[model samples]
Target chain A: MTAHATPDDVKKLAALARLTVSEEELPAFVAEFEAILGYVGQLETLDIAAGSDILPYANTFRTEGTPHEKGVWTPDIVKAFPNREGDALSVKQIIAND
Target chain B: MESNLASLTITEAARKLRAKECTVRELWGACHAAAKTDAVHAYLEVFDADDAAIDAAQARIDAEGENASVLCGIPLAIKDNILIKGKVASAASEMLEHYEATYDATAIKKLRNAGALFLGRTNMDEFALGGSTENSAFGPTTNPHDTDRVAGGTSGGSAAAVAAHTAIASLGSDTGGSVRNPASYCGVVGFKPTYGSISRSGLIAAASSFDQIGPITKTVADAKALFDVLRGTDVLDSSTAPEGSYPEFTHEVKTIGVPRSLLEQGLDPYVVQAFNTALEATGCKIVDIEIPSNKPALAAYYIINFAEVSTNLSRLDGIRYGHAARGETLLDDYLLSRTEGFGKETKRRILLGTFVLSAGYIDAYYRKAVAARSALIREFDEAFKTVDVIATPTMPTPAFKIGEKSDPLSLYLEDVFTVTANLTGMPAISVPMGTVDREGTKLPIGIQFTAPRGADERVFTIAAAVTGEQLY
Candidate 1:
């Protein structure tokens, strides 16, 4: 009763999540993924009729029109970064030049 | 009464402090001596024995006279996931091995103001992922009772510390029974308040929606005292409701709803016998209520857990903080860092999370789980109209041997009885009912009580009754 995740599927997932998986670890991860997915797949058998929302209710704490404020990052916290330049965290460029 | 200072509950310790029968220094000394040992591997780091906090508490007691807070001068163990400013706050993972907290969590700040002294950071499941402390980057914390068994996880160290009398009480974060499960295994009181009852400002996020910082103590009274001190709205946490947001639960508990259907599989006979005996002792009406969503609650809980964990842990990309690895490109940096930093369970969850939340599968897996979750909430709301609390054995079985249940799925199934409360956002507590024997050694199991949202008082009341102690 398992719709198993293939080795290729595992590789794709590892890449998507920015995690490296070695050849030795791939099979174990695949087996675990298959087991977990098959187990959680029981939700598919649950029939929720149409017109019923998945997220039906919000708690009392969820208030509308609450103004949000930007959080300020303290310098001490910024300095904790591995690649810091002049009190700012330095990161490699994300843009691609084709 | 036990003369051993380490064995004193928080209430008793506070009373002793008030009467000047035991100085805070002596209390700290006893707990410190207990903390110094690594026999159970309970502590990741025990703070320096000579701490100024003891002196500070004494000074405050001298000034305030009879007005000191109940937690004043109490030595407590803290889970590694909660941040204590300027101290190393690894979630028992190599990812944050050298990471130091820049500020105290809201809970820690409140405890500090209450004059509670932190003994040290205790070990836990790496990023609170697994049910057993065996996932801890440091070695697993063995059960204090048997020493050959586990002390439950991800709050294993905190529970073990309290059980072993290393600290009068300890604070643990429960995402999915992290606090309660360990509390059951350790034979102590562990409480998980309704979600958002306590501020989550300083806890390292696991499953954001389900995580709560709570207390593990020797008695329900002690747990209640810590919960009172810790529960409140914080501007730092948006999910928290203002103080007194939910009307106080004044309804007396006379009926307990037990979902008989959910107990059909996996529950141990010994635990069932203990639960039945406890139920008889309570003399409260046992109503066999059906929570239809209970069937899928575990599945839904894990789906939500994985999805949230995938998102929450995405921030540990090595550039801003945590252990970093030099690589040719930015992608490589993240991949290499996370690959080396995370444990086996953490990586597996992250992968499954990525799968369920992926493009083609979101609607089928994640969305359906949410619907199941809603169904669960509705069923619970309906059930609470008749019963004030729901009762179950905290775990399906007693504490397994240290290396038992090697399979991840088997480990996840252990959370079956405890995860429903987290899923429905209800308050639950694990109170030690009695011990059940495993082999030749006797292992303790707890009875869990789940109350409606914001009905924390009801949960405590029933729990106090079950434990045969008056709490507050």
Candidate 2:
């Protein structure tokens, strides 16, 4: 797995992570991925059981209850948005025109 | 006068404040003045002492006398990752560099209620990703002992501030050695309480399960003082343990476990010698113990770190808040913002995280790491049955020269000893053992004591014994 990581694999990983790696930086990143993956790959040698639990505890869900007031934080939250109009946050359109 | 005042421990400062020997304004003035001459770049921002907060603390002391909280009027530094309402909680990253925290972190609220003064927000690894704060967007925090060397990080600034006497104490969030690593490098005391002992509601997440807010102070007693104020359950962070979630160790620490195999290689000769000296000084029976899982602990820890960091940081997509970049498409927006906002180390972790959790590879990497985690925890549990505490060199080597470790894996390997406590959700402390010379300069090293989960007090008890300090 360490030697197998290529520039293309890193490009795909960067895309999956929503990060951009420039052409000049791809080789260095791929090299780093190989080195890191090789190091972490040592875990493959461990004789873990077939059905060990990942976490010590089960998933925890907060009890269903009354939510905080709707507009109490709206103004403050809206103030942090990068692009906003009135109280609504704006983003680049995702839908294609027919 | 200011330097001497700045050097006072939290307990000493509190005593002075109570005796009316120094006003809250004077204490803040001493710390603020020291912070202004910070050659190590320990602070991201040294806040102007809030007049109301000062007057309020002074008033409390004047009105309540000895009844006032011991922390009242004591100046402390906060890691940038922890939120303080209306202050910039950047986590030392450009993405959220300008973002102001809308609400106070649970820890901040507790400290405020205790009347602790906020001297500043300290620098750290960007998003707490790197072991050395060289990854900080603002700049690296150099060690106070040696400016050419790094203050071990991602809590580097917090530790450096205390070591330099810029603040009496500071809070640092440790996931894998973040607090203790820096404390070891800077020659101060750092403690990571039992995983859920401290709430994470206001802390910027690095890895969900591993992160625990801890204290960095001049003495073990000071660390204990801050921990007492910070530890507890919080409604906002459900991960916080309820009262008696872990059984208390009622017996005295009579034996210490040494994982001799793990220390046979890679540690500095001086560090090993210092550790041996510190262990003997504990006056506890020493016994050899083997937890083979310790070898793969770093690998497992990093796998989980990448996976969680990738998932946790996904919230910063540039739509609602944080650094934004214009792009033709929505996807393009995310890529551009993240690319421009994050440092190389941060992007590297996020990519590694995505790789491990991606389809087809999840079982091979992420799942395997998870099982390995369980195995490691079980091994620690088994080891603890025979020993009350485990002793090790807090770091493999003392603070390395700045730019010394250019490779990322090298830095990850430095966390070999400290990550085990986080992996097992146990409490650990690093006490300054002694100094080891690096060339003409004498660099400080630390000896770490790890106790069973919920045995946080035991770690402090043993640490105080090793350092010959009275526990608070």
Candidate 3:
């Protein structure tokens, strides 16, 4: 594991997280990240021999229920959309032009 | 006139309403007036009294008489994260600044059925990420007692409203002491019930496994009354525990455990003294106990918190709802919207979460945190075999001056004592212990009591005993 997060590492992580950390904020972000990492790094010393049983999964099933009436929430949902085109949400194009 | 009405506890207010000493509108008026002059800035919006809800509550009280729920006609402040259909539930973040809830949170629905009045949504750390409300996209909620001091948070506004008498009680979600920290700092009672005891449906997601909608109120009984109404299984939230999900806690608290080793350092003298006094007043046997994994519990808690936050917040991609920004490319839209939408602390946590959960680092960080969490839970389970409950100073010190803990690590350290309950999914409550003096001002601190999972009633009983309040 890396000992500390550098400014570059923070910038990369920001990009991955879909956040944009400005160049000016990178140093401070890196410093805070390193501090937090150091703090949580205490867990690295903990022996997990008795604790490795972490994923305790249980299947919970629910009875089928009638769905909400169509269009009941559509207006509110569509209204909250930042950009709407008629009845549908509008977004920037994702397909590449041939 | 309204101030006196505002100051009455929920039980007292209910009794008075029953006796026809005050009208429902009058209580609302009192609280509204308090909110109007509130220097604490607890509420993001102090809604104009819901005339219909007030009328309905009064009609219920008039018809049911003594059979009315104690919360009937009570004015309650809601944390911004809990949805109230047709009302804004921003989680105090800019991303959802104008986002109105399309449906009521399960807790809000329960409270509405009981005829509780919604005063307004209170401020919090944006998306409930920080220990202090200063991280709010709006502004920080100052301690009601001392305007210069911070009301500890992510639930700072909820606690502040209750403490400031702007609301009879409030609901705040606790992931890691979000409710109790503010309650402790503001000198009120904050309770985090067993993780699944209260349905999480409609409450905005933070750390799903750790989050529980809890009550911040003037007294422990008020908290219990609210909790009783809010806790139950829900079809929408599969994580909610069914009735009898865990073994019942039948006996009164007989033995209380003190993790004295953890308390040996970093506690204010006032907090140390108040905790001891509160425990002694309970008249329960106190014994030293050790949970070795607790040493690394905060670290584990934050790791899990970051991971969950990153996952939960991904839903806000600026496509369907909430804040959106235009960018040349689709990927840039997500980045631009998020960067402009979230505050610094939120972005920091998101990055940390991404790092921990990233492919190369997942095993080193995420897996380790999960394992450590399991060990901590097991350790707590072992401790409960011998003790009826555990006690600690809710905060290491009284409310610090606003901006005192600018360093994120220092702020995170304030949560060291409270994160254990969230991590282990145990029930915990912070009752006003007493106050400590700083700069000639008295600041409140709290004594926290934690019980085994599903032993929620046990903590209330002990807390009532300590606070000298009647359990009823």
TM value for model 2: 0.98
Candidate 3 chain B weakest ten by summed lDDT:
B242-251
DockQ class, candidate 3: medium
Candidate 2, residues A1-98, lDDT tens digits: the string is 43368989998988888998999999898888888999998877677896875555433346778999879988778989999879999877788798
Error of 1 at A58 (Å): 5.5
Evaluated on the second chain alone, the candidates' TM-scores are: 0.98, 0.99, 0.99
For B1-472, candidate 1 gives per-residue lDDT tens digits of 2228988999989888888898889999888887886578899999985467899898877678579888989999999999999899999999998999988999999999999999999999999999879999888999998998999999999999999888899999999999999999999999999888898999999998889998999999999999999998877887776666566777478999999988888888989999989987888999999998888889999999999999999999998899999788888898999999999999999999998899888888888888888888889989988998899999999899988888899899899988988888789999999998878888999999999888898888888888898755
Residue pairs with backbone atoms closer than 3 Å in model 1 (clashes): none
- Output the lDDT of residue A34, model 2: 83
Q: Per model, how many backbone clashes are there?
A: 0, 0, 0
lDDT of 2: 0.91
lDDT of 2 by residue, B1-472 (tens): 7678899999899899888788889989999999988989999999987999999999999999889888998899999999999999999999999999999999999999999989999999999988889999998999999999999999999999999999999999999999999999999999999988888999999999999999999988898888889888777888888776677575378999999999998889989988998888788999999998898888989999999999999998888889999888888889889999999999999999999998877887888888888998899999999999999999999999999899899999999999998898989999999999988999999999999888888988899998888764
Query: Which runs in model 2 stand beyond 4 Å of their true positions?
Result: A1-3, A58-66
Best by DockQ: 2
Question: Could you tell me the lDDT of residue B332 within candidate 2?
Answer: 84
Cα lDDT tens digits for candidate 1, A1-98: 33569999999999999998999998888887878888999988889653454432234444456563544456658868899887778888888898
Which pairs of residues collide in model 3?
A: none
- Give all TM-scores, in the order shown: 0.95, 0.98, 0.98
